[model samples]
Target: MVDQLRPNPAYIEAVLADAALSPYRTWMGLGITELECDRALVVLDIEDHHLQLRGTVAGGVMASLIDTATFWSAFVRAPADAGVANVDLRVNYLEAVPKGARRLIAEGRCLRPGRRLSYAEAYVRDERGHVVAHGMSSVLTLAGKGLAIDLPKYLEENE
Candidate 1:
């Protein structure tokens, strides 16, 4: 089944482009280096704003990275019009990211994919290749509501 889930090149390209253009992804400096049937690789260059007073990467940033990577891992198998919503997310902070680390890499893989739900896991590693955090997520797949879809004009106007 996994073998049959391979994403086409165009779909992969679209996913990467959307990730690059998303406002939140842009703000977080997230970049998608690879996207496959059930796996994804993402990177974030460390910045001052991403750190805490203790000089370590903030937990929220790590969480967001995990979530995004996990979502994409499952999304590669979803219908073009499908959207993903978080059902649950669990993260284990294994070690603090060092202050001097220049970048963080997140590798995510889908454990299972289904019509209504998907499960995925992600590991965040520092530039030194030490795992700083690990995460697992379950997502609800919503058909006919893709992440890349434009919102209604009325909704945008109201906002």
Candidate 2:
């Protein structure tokens, strides 16, 4: 099993900031206000863009939620690097989210964190109290300085 590391305060702050600025257009501007790994809880707030054609939460949105949540699960169990890269991700959508499913919340946990990879699972539930989607994924660390400390204000504080 790969040894998990603790995230410095700055790194955590930056990740939350990244969640706000996530480049994925679907989740762009979205924010996950609360998160913890020991208990494996992931909470996120949905914005207008997450809605689908009928105003129901889009399937893609749910997928993103699962992916993001599982990422955090793995992140908390892996080396503290803000720049971990996804080696692969696969999802299975189980149900449609009703319009205004209320608030989106994802619950996920780390399955394993090996020397070279990390695996995690997450389920997306609509505010309606229905399972919207489920997913699992793996991440691969790449060549980079990686995040080790409170990210310098230069990184998180900036774009």
Candidate 3:
């Protein structure tokens, strides 16, 4: 069996910083706080735009959080020349978050990592630690098709 892979500190910092440059991630105010060999933690500070007509957190926001967190959890284990793409995502909204909620915490874990595919799950909690949503995803590991951008250049250009 191949040894499990872990992202080094530099790689972790790179990923966290690069993620902020993504238009969608930036618009959603997503921030990565911690990364491990098989897991990642992300945060979103709620803003007015994140609320729906009902004054609750938008479902789309939660879905995006789940997808992003799950993707990164598996991404850390992929080879340098490989990239993981989400094949399917399923999310369950457990509770509605009040508009006044200060933040949301998302935790994602890779359940299985394979050469061609991977599985991951994630959960979102409000500032009070109430479960707001949960999700699972199937991701395809594409060999010879790594991330399109050069991390160093991307960072420099964004900065």
Listed in order, each prediction's TM-score against the native is: 0.87, 0.70, 0.87
The top-ranked prediction according to TM-score is: 1
The lowest-lDDT stretch of 10 consecutive residues in candidate 2 is 1-10
* Candidate 2: clashing residue pairs, number: 1
Top candidate, metric lDDT? 3
Give the per-residue lDDT digits (tens) of candidate 1, residues 1-159: 122366546556655776678888999998888888778888999999999999889999899889888988888787766778768899999999987889999998999988899899999999999999999999788888775634353234333
List runs of model 3 lying over 4 Å from the truth. 1-4, 148-159
lDDT at position 149, candidate 3: 43
- Per-model lDDT: 0.82, 0.62, 0.83
Give the true-structure RMSD of model 1: 6.5
Arranged by lDDT, best first = 3, 1, 2
> Which model is ahead, 1 or 3, in terms of TM-score?
1
The candidate, 1 or 3, that scores higher on lDDT is: 3
Q: In candidate 2, what are the lDDT values of residues 1-159, reduced to their tens digit?
A: 112454455555655665555466333433455555421455556667766666767777766667777666766544444355566778888877665555767887777765567788888776776777888888664535354445445445543
How high is the lDDT of residue 76 in model 1?
Answer: 75
